[model samples]
Target: MTDSTRPTALVTGSAGFIGMHVCERLLADGYRVVGIDSMSDYYDVALKEARHARLARSNGFTAEVGRIEEPERLMRLFEANTPDLVVHLAAQAGVRYSIENPRSYVEANLQGTFELLEAARAHPPEHMLLASTSSAYGASTEMPYRETMKADTQMSFYAATKKATEAMAHSYAHLYGLPISMFRFFTVYGPWGRPDMALFKFTRAILTGEPIDIYNHGEMSRDFTYIDDLVEGIRRLADAVPERPEGGVVPEGDSLSPVAPFRVVNIGNGAPVPLMEFVRAVEAATGREAEKRYLDMQPGDVPATWADTSLLNALTGYAPTTPVEEGVGRFVDWYRGYYAV
Candidate 1:
C-alpha cells in the first residue's frame, strides 16, 4: 500500500537506463513510484534486471513486469495506482535495431504509446512527460535544434515513431485537456547506459584491445547529455506543466501548443562534441587507446545533432551543460567497475 500523503508516479520502462535513474530521483524526492517494464531482449536483460533490483530496494518504488502495449494491464495499473504523474519512457530504442526490426518499433513505440494515451485519457494525470529524441529533428541541418522548429523530416523509423508519439500525445492533450510535455533528448550517455550505445561499445572494445567502429570517419558530432543532468532536467520539467496559451500567442522561443496544454522541450548538453574527441575522452578514462575502424556513415544516421535549450531554460530555470570529458570519465569508471576490466 502506498502512503496517501505522497504523490504517486507511474513510470513505464522502469528497468531501462533512464527509467531506473528517474525512478531513483522520484523516490528520493518522496514520491511513490510505480515502475513497469517488459524486460525485452533488445539489449542485456541482465542489465535491466539489475536496474530493477536497485529500485526494488526502495520502499516507495513498486516494480511491475509488463509491456505498455498491453492496454488492459496498463489500465489496471492506472486504476490501482491512480498516479498523479505519468512518465512514458518504454519504447523499442536504437536506430539500427529499428531498421533490422521495424515491426518492434511499430508495436512498442506506436502501439504501446497508443495504449498509454488511452489509459491516461481514462485516468488523467496532472502532468504527463513523454520521451522523444533528437533524431526527430532528422535531415534538418539546422544547428542547435529548437523545439518550435518543424520536425517532420525524420530519417529513421525510430525517429518517425517518436515523432508520431508526439503527435498522438498532442491530440490527446487537445481533446482531453491533459497537460503534456515531450522531452527531446540528445545523445544521452553515462553509467548504466544501454549496451547498444556508442559509449558502452567503445569502452568495451578499447578495454578488450579490439577495433571500435567510427562511423562517418570520425566526422560526426553529438550533443552528449549526461544521464544525471538529463534526469535533473526531467525532474524540474515535471513541475513545469504547460498550459494552452491564451490568444494563441506562445511566448517567443517556446513550443507550447496554442490549442492545448502541450509542449516539447529539448534536454541536452547544448555542446556538440566531435566523435574523435569523445573517443579520446574514453581513452583518457580507460587509459587505453581504441583501435579505430573508420566506416562510411550508416543509413538513417545524421552527421550531427545540437539542441537549442532556450525553452528548457526559460521553463525550468536550468539546462544540461555537462562537459563530455567528465561525463565520459564517469561512464568509463562505471564500465570498469561493473565489468571488472
Candidate 2:
C-alpha cells in the first residue's frame, strides 16, 4: 500500500541511466517511487540490475520488471500507485541501432508510448514528463534548437518515433486534459551512464589501449548535458506542469500547445562542444591519449546539436550548467572505479 501522506511517482525505465538518477532524486525528495523496467538485454542486464539494486536501498522504491508495452502493465501500475508524477524514459535508444533493428523502435518507442498514454488517460497524473531527443530537431541547420521551432524533419527512425510520440501525447493531453511536458534532451552523459554512450565507450577504449572511433572525421559537436543537471531540470519541470492556456493564446517563444496542457522543453547545457575537444577532455581525465580512428558519419546522425534553454529557464527558473569536460571527467572516474580498469 502506498503511503497516503507521500506523493507517488511512477517511473518507467527506472533502471536506465537517466531513469535511475531521476528515481534517486524523487526518493530523496520524499516521493514514493514505483519503478517498472523490462531489464532489456540491449546493453548489459547487469548494469541495469545494479542500478535497480541501488534504488532498492530506499524503502520508498518498489520495483516491477516488465515492458511498458505489455498489455495491462502500465495500466495496472497506474491504478496501483495512482502516481502524482510520471516520468517516461524507457525507449529503444541509439540512432545507428535503429537502422539495424527498426522494429524494436516501433515496439518500444511507439507501442510502448501508446500504452503509457492510454494508461495515463485512464488514470490522470498531476504531471506526465516524457523524454524526447534533440535528434527530433533533425538536420536543422539552426545552431540552437528551440521548442517553438518546426521539428518535422527527423533523420532517423528512432527520432521519427520519438517525434511521433510528441504528437501522440499532445492529442491525448488535449482530449483527456492530461498535463504533459515533453523533454528534448541533448547529449546526456554522466556517472552510471549507459555503456553504449560515447563518453563510456571512449573512456573504456582509451584506458584499454583500443582506438576510439571519431565519426564525421572529428567535426561534430553536441550540447553534452550532465546527468545530475538533467535530473535537476526534470525535477523542477515536474513542478512546473503545463496548463492549457485560456483562449489558446500561448506566450511568445513558449511551446505550450494551444489546445492542450502540453509543452516541449529542451534540457541541455546550451553549449555545443566539438567532438575532438570532448576526446581531449577524456584524455585529460584518464591521463592517456586515445588512438583515434576517424570515420565517415554514420547514417541517421547529425553533425551538431545545440539547444535553446530559454523556455526551460522561463518555466522552471532553471537551466543545465554542467560543462562537458567536467561531466566527462566524472564519468571517467566512475568508469575506472566501476570496471576497476
Candidate 3:
C-alpha cells in the first residue's frame, strides 16, 4: 500500500478493459487495491490475462481469479479485505452477445451483483460505484442522455440487466444505507480495448485487407469516449459520492432515492461523432482504407448513443472531453504496435 491514509479499494473486473485502467488510476492515487475477476473467455482470455499481468507488477494492487457470483468466496473476500471503497466493474458485457446468451448476463450482472450487495450489507463500504451501460437508455430517441431521464424500456437483454442492477443497487442503498453511484458509460475505446468493439474490429479489418461490418448501413453515431477520459471521470466520482439528502426530499423522477445515498451519473463525451468520421480517423492513423461491408442493424443495437453529461459536470466539475479523432488515432497506434501490424 503506497498511502496508508488512503482507503483500501476493491475493483471488480479489474482484468477487463475499463477495469485495467481503473486499477491503474486507483494505484496511482495511492489506494491499497484488491481486484477480483473471473477472466471469462467472452473475448480473448489472453487479453484479460495480459491486463492482470500488468496489474500484478504493482505492489499496491492484488488480484484473485474467481467469479463474483460465488457468495461464499465473495463473502470471505469482503470479510478479509474490509475495503473502505468498492468499484463494481465486472460483468458479462456486450449488447449483441446478450442476445445469444442471456443466461450469462443473469449470472454475472444480476446474480453477481446480488452477491456483492448481500456482502456489503454486513460490511458497508463508504462508497460503491457500479458499471452501467448507455444501452440502458434504450428505445429513447433522446439525444444527450441525462441521469434523471426515464430509461424503463431497454432494447438489449444485457442493458436490461444493467439497468436492473441500478435499481437493485438503489434498493440496497435505501435499505442498508450504502452510498452507491451507478455510472452509465457510453461507447468507450482506447488502448487495451475489448476485441469485440467496433473500433478494434474496424482497425484490424482495415489493416488486414478484410471488410469491416458497418452496421445500420453506416448511419450510426456514438459519443465515443476515450478510456483515459472515462477513467478520470470515475476517479473524480470516487470522492464526490452522494449523501442522503438531509431533508429527504429528493428530486422528482430521479434515480436518486430519498432514503438512500444513491444516484446515477452519465460518463460520456458529449460530442457524438458519425461512423464514417470515426473510421476516417482510424484510416488516417493506419494509412489504409478499410474494406467496408454495409450491414443491416443487428438486434438489440441502437442507432446512436449521446450522453448529456451536464449533471456530471455540475456535480463533479468534469465530464469526458476526448475528441473522437484523437481518441481513435491513439487506439490505432496502440493496436498496430500491439499486433505488429
Best by lDDT: 2
Q: What does the lDDT read for residue 25 in candidate 3?
A: 92
lDDT (Cα, tens digit) per residue for candidate 3, span 152-245? 9999999999999998999998888899999999999999999999899998888889998888888999999999999999998898878888
Candidate 2 residue lDDT tens string, 1-341: 34678999999999999999999999999999999999999999999999999999997999899998888889998988899999999999999999999999999999999999999999999999999999999988977999988999999999999999999999999999999999999999999999899998999899999999999999999898999999999999999989999999999999999999999999999999999999999999999999999999999999999999999999989978877788888998899888888
Per-model C-alpha lDDT, please?
0.93, 0.94, 0.90
Q: What is the lDDT of residue 265 in candidate 3?
A: 89
| Clash total of candidate 3 | 2
- Across 190-289, the per-residue lDDT of candidate 1 in tens digits comes to 9999999999999999999999999999999999999999999999999999998889898888899999999999999988999999999999998987
For model 3, the stretches where C-alpha displacement exceeds 4 angstroms are: 1-6, 251-255
Which model, 1 or 3, shows the larger lDDT?
1
Off by over 4 Å in 1: none
TM-score of 3: 0.97
Candidate 2's error at 248, in angstroms? 0.7
Tell how far residue 35 is off in model 1, in angstroms.
0.4
